[model samples]
Target: MLHLVTGHAGFIGFHTACRLLERGDGVIGLDNLNDYYDPALKQARLAALQALATRTGGFYRDVRANLADAAAVDAVFAQHRIERVINLAAQAGVRYSLQNPRAYVESNISGFVNLLEACRHHGVGHLSYASTSSVYGASTALPYSEHVAADHPLQFYAATKRANELMAHAYSHLYRLPTTGLRFFTVYGPWGRPDMAPFLFTRAILEGRPIQLFNHGRHSRDFTYVGDIVEGVLRASDRPAAPDPAWTSAAPDPARSNAPWRVYNLGASAPVALVDFIDALEAAIGKPAIRELAPLQPGDVPDTAADTTGLQADVGYAPATPLREGVQRFVDWYRGFYKV
Candidate 1:
């Protein structure tokens, strides 16, 4: 199958595309390579993908364009027989959204709608896009389930992701499109984004700088590994959503609908405290971090956990990498990549 992956230069997108290529699937990677983090890192990932294609003898195509450009997105669909699409392109970051709401709207909302339009027009079999755990904002729900109400989002970033789910549902209902929205928790691993906690903490520790511990080290996250996430993504892509026969409007489940729409939480299910994560990182790096406790930032959740039952039941897989092991792998990659 020929799969189209948006944000192919991104951390998750790069890993997903590489895995697809390793499995001998035709892949068309699309990314604007925005400087949300380091475009150099993104470029390196793209180069790795190209090298992998040559090594594995996989069909790989690269498209450099912004998803928000209607003409660009349409041209991609026009040029390729894209059977499935994994939309990971977004202006991601919780706190960054505070300063740049317009960026979120332009990339996450507008860009997503453009892809949906192309998918609907091109008769794409399945469409899987990234949502976020932040959508469960202000809810003290433990191990958030797909059935839980997630109408309240704390940040503009989370709100955009929630809007994608709604927008996807509307498209699915109106056009019978098979759509799957993945609510990703804290994903961390090698080639990860620098904005995330893992990279920030690692860099700070290596540089002998103080690592900021938000919520006074009380915050917890379901830090999933990127490799596990890739497994779930491919499985979800293979299984196109179908209308739920059990769906009823009286007490409708937030996860499934009468339309061919479904949502699943992808996470490790293991919520580790901020302090514990720091300890793991320190162990991996062979050094202790200088900690600076700080109050929680605006729109920051104190804790997040994923129920992942729906994902496991549907795709027969869930994120399983332990925190210590995953952190070690990331640290090794960091040391090698940056020669630290």
Candidate 2:
């Protein structure tokens, strides 16, 4: 199968594209190589993909283009025999969104609209896109379920992701496009974004700096591994969404629709405390972190737990990596990559 993977140089996109190439799927990767975190790291990921493709004798062509450009997206669709699309490109960061809300609008909203338009016109078979767990914003619910209403988004980033879900649903309903949205929960592992907790904590700990614990170490997150995330993503992409026979408008489930569209939580289903996660990182690095407990930042949720039953039932998605093991793997890669 020929796969069109946006943001192929990103952490999750790199891993997914590598796996697809390893499995003999030809991949055309699209990425702008934006300096959201570090363009060097993104370049390194792209280089690694090229090396992997050469070794495997599989096709991995990368096109440097922004998803916000409608003509660029359309050009790629017109050029390639694209069977499926994995939309992972976005301006990804809750705090960053506060500083530059326009970036979110341009990338997450406008960019997603361009991709949807290309998919609609190109007759793509399955459209799988990345949605964040942050969409379950300000909810006091313990285990976030897909069926629950997600109308309340705390941050602009979350709002844009939620808007993507709605837009995808519209495309699916209007054009019979098979669309699947995977709400990722606290994804972390090697090659992660520097803005994220795991990478920040690891860097601070290694450099003998104090690590800030938001909400005074009271917050909890699902902390899913990237490998597990890629697995779930691949499975979800393979299974084209279908209309739910049980769906009804009277008591509508937000996760599924009468059209060929669905949303599922891709998470570990186990919430780990912020302090515990820090301890795991410390253990992995063989160093103790200097902690500075702080109040929770605005647009930040206190806790998050995923109800992955819907994903499990639909696509056999089960996150199998343990927190300690996953943290160890990340620490190993971080040390090797940074030469720390």
Candidate 3:
């Protein structure tokens, strides 16, 4: 399979691309390598991918370009015979959206449309894109299900991602495109984003700095490991979406449609409190954290628990890693990578 993966230098994207390459698939990786967090980390991930491709004898091409550029996207499609598209690119960070709204509109909305247009024109077989558990915003439901209506988004970032689902659905309906939107829960692991809690907490603990606990350590999250997430992505990519035979217009399922479109929540299906997760980190690192409890920030949810039954039923998606084991792996990687 020839796969085109946007944001291929990103945490999940890099891992996903590597997995595909290891299986002897040709991978075209597109990433702008922006300095949103640190471009150096992105570069390092790309270097690792290059090394993996060399070692595995798998064809890999690293394309440095922004997804917002229509010409660039169109050119890539014209150049390569792309069979599938795994779009992991977007202006991520919920708080960042509050500060810079245009970034989300440009990357998440406009850039997404460009990809959709290219996919429609290029005859791509299947398009699997990343969504977020944050899309379940404003819904006080525990164990968020794919079947529930996710109409309300708490933040602009979540709103943009929700918009992506709607946009994908429209394209799928109008052009008969096969699209699958994977609503990933709080993901963490080695090479994780520095902006996330795991990385922040680990770094702070290692440096003897104070780690901020939002919502007074009361909020919980379904923190899925990156490896598990990549597994689900691969499985979903292998299966092109088909119209749900049981779908009906009268009681339209939010996750499925009569068109070739579907949505699935990908997570560990286990919620761990912030303080307990910190405890896991402390155990993994053999050090205690200097905690600074703070009130919940704007656009932050109290908890997120994924009801992954839909994903498991559709793609046999099962998250295999335990939280402690995953955190330990991450801590080990952090120490080794940073020479801490």
lDDT of 2 by residue, 155-224 (tens): 9999999999999999999999999999999999999988899999999999999999989999999999
Candidate 2 has an lDDT of 0.95
Candidate 3 structure quality by residue, lDDT tens digits, 1-340: 8999999999999999999999999999999988899888998999999999999999999999899999999999999999999999999999999999999999999999999999999999999999999999999899999899998899999999999999999999999999999999999999999999899999999999999888888999999999999999999999999998999999999999999999999999999998999999999999999999899999999999999998898889899999999999999999998999
Q: What digit string (tens of lDDT, one per residue) describes model 1 on residues 1-340?
A: 9999999999999999999999989999999998888899999999999999999999999999999999999999999999999998999999999998999999998999899999999999999999999999989879898898898899999999999999999999999999999999999999999999899999999999999888898999998999999999899999999999999999899999999999999998989888999999999999999999899999999999999989899889867788899999999999999999
Residue pairs with clashing backbones, model 2: none
RMSD of each: 0.7, 0.6, 0.6
Q: What is the lDDT of residue 209 in candidate 1?
A: 96
Q: Supply candidate 3's per-residue lDDT for 296.
A: 95
Worst 10 residues of 1 by lDDT: 314-323
Worst 10 residues of 3 by lDDT: 308-317
